[model samples]
Target: MSLSIGLVVHASRRGVFEEAVEPVSGVSLKWVTYGHERDIRPHVQSLVDGHALDGLLVGAVPYRACRDVLPRTLPVAVTRNSALDLALALGQAQARGWQAVPVSIDTFDHEVVCEVTESLHLDRTRVTCLPYADDQSVDEICAFHRRSLHDGDGYVITARTAVLRQSRGDLRVLNGSPTPSSIRSELRELLLRIRSERAGAAGFAAGVFCVSRHGCPGDPERSRMDLLHLLRATPELTDAWIENRGRRGVVVLGRRTLFERLSRDWLVAPVLDRAQESLNVPVSAGFGVGSSARTSVVLAERAAVRAESENRPCGYLMEDSGLVLGPIGPGGLGGPGGPGGRSAGQWTGPPTARPHREQGDRMRELARTVGLSPATLSRLAAIEHDVAGRAVTPSELADAMAVTDPSGRRLVRKLHAHGLVTSEGWAQTHRKGRPTGLYRLAIVAALTGSADGHALETV
Candidate 1:
């Protein structure tokens, strides 16, 4: 599918961006041009409201002006003048017989100015630079250029169109806007980000529905069949493939976007509540998104286990990118108890006595014993549950935790020191590299007060 992109630029620089984007294929551009920064917000708002844009490319001035109006989820790239742009402007000035020394520059970073000057063998001490600030005004920029001119500087260079236009009659102002190459680079990067986001939204998604044993005391096979029938009857899940998973679980397979919409961006899944109420039993639903069906199903099963741990009719969503969403229950839609409203490790139960609350406290205590934060411990526990007592390499652990390989190695070392992990034999997963050491995680055992009964004290 061709992507729609929004471009916000000053009138003076619109031509440059237009020419640069003209040759790009599979993209349709929506332009929002303004003569001044103050006039950009409404135009940007109109563009956004009128177009279903895949991404946006804007300059720093327009970005600062309309950032509050931009949608939080929209992919945006802020283009800035690079060091090469500064060097090119300087080369043009020198060719016109303008002195490079004793010149004032604005909107560019001090480091960029220093690099250009040093490379050109110019006197750094003679150059004055005013770096860009979010709250800076064009009038203030113009005042700085006037002051520099009065102080005997040869010329002034500015990246703001307003400052350049207002001071051109009196002061020798050079255009410091980014070159076409710089803008094209930013546009290409933004396009790639947009495409990646689209691909992820279309990826494989799996949902696991497990009946709570305590809530429904009956034959496991019957409960699984009931759950499957409930999901098959759900209108929102009509497009999904529903089937029996295990002894007491049902699985639903569909695209990631389907689940995202039904769950309201992974914040809440009211269908879960309806299923629980209709079946007169607590049902835990877990949703997962990944690149492949097996990975998505594994993640979905793990998330289902997490929801079951709550011991209530709730739901959780897990992504291959290491994002965990909820314990989405009653009062979740548009309420403060929605997915991002609470910490990942926090229980949704009342403040008083509850099984989930007690379980949380035990986990927190175990985290303290291991000198790790409760949040970190919660993630580690999830990893341990996902692996199901199997040995894991540091690289695999790193992927599960969404951390660097070095950080994963350090985590393994820490867990080994605390007796929460044990070393297993090495395995060669790749042909070229040496065999990676394997370790089995015992965090779940420690949390349950069963880790060898020595290294980890019972909570």
Candidate 2:
């Protein structure tokens, strides 16, 4: 779609502006004329709502006039009585042989007038600057211009359209306006920012890690707790959880920016190495990327299993396209047993070996532990794959999981009791309505002696 741009111009100067510039090539312009610069904000906002403008170009509006009223989120460009514009007005005076004539300028500091005079090699005493405070009115500005014309030379310049309307004969008025080039530059920058933000918001990634604590024979429980803390402390992992009774590993969700860091080997490998070094454990983590949360977590589980079977301190990445890559090992292993031994970065074997449980048995066990129906847990597991590590409102959960809102709320509360999720806070949608509660998923439910688990809770 072509960018929609709104222009707020003084009603008197609109004609001159229309004559100077034709329609911009790639944008649709919606113009709103205002009697005063300070009053332009409401009209500009109206244009924004009416036309859905992507950017705004405010003409001859002083920075002081609209700074408080302008929308902070929208890309806004305002015309000011800048230093260059002061030079333009001075040049006009010099052109008319008004070098000896006393010049009057509105909305300019006396210091600036002195600088302009110095640059023009004119006597500073011959120039008069009238700087108006935010409280000054258009009538007061016109009165200053009128007095200057009557008491001194007629050469005058102003930013206010009120003074321009009163100009006649030798009382020349030059409206301090932003050049076409400046407006174009601002628009270009705004478009660049918009494009960058859209690209970042395209998609996000989530990974479920199944860690085997076999290598750490010394205080394995402490190591497991430390691993959990490490996962939570890392800034890159948006959300992290142990997801099981025995703390097999953590499930991590990352936004697009963090996923990009993972692609660069800056996030994942360093984290794995840190966990290995800190916990004195050989870490095997699986990472997956998919369009939905369920797909990503499932793929990540497969990768973790692959890493475990290989007995290496490595990571496997499963792409959304179902392509599996690598028993990719960490770069360095400076753990308890040195680089060459099993404790360095390689898993020797499971310390306390137990009989493996099948998926059906694991599900039944998890359902019993959480005190929820197997079918409900199964439904939750299916929904977990699609969560993508996001916090959800009751309505959002209902829509995504194909349940009633009340049912979703009840299910989440049950999962909370099982230590799978927690209440984050409330988000207010409107001023008059009740606030919606936000819940973050804390853990997934994994059955004893099995890698198989169900999605528990989500933010």
Point to the candidate with the largest TM-score.
1
Superposed model 1: Cα runs more than 4 Å off: 38-55, 65-75, 93-103, 110-127, 146-150, 169-172, 212-222, 278-280, 330-459
lDDT for each residue of candidate 1 in 2-86, tens digit (9 for 90 to 100) = 8899999888788999888877889988999898677899999999899898888988778878988888667777777677888
Clashes of each: 0, 10
Local error of candidate 2 at 355, Å? 52
- Give Cα-based local distance difference scores for all models: 0.74, 0.57
Score every model by TM-score: 0.63, 0.43
What's the CA RMSD for each of the models? Answer: 14.3, 23.7
lDDT (0-100) at residue 178 of candidate 1? 92
Predicted candidate 2 versus true structure: per-residue lDDT over 289-347, tens digit per residue: 66666766776777777768876566666554333445454544443566533444343
The window of 10 residues in a row where model 1 has the poorest summed lDDT is 450-459
lDDT of 2: 0.57
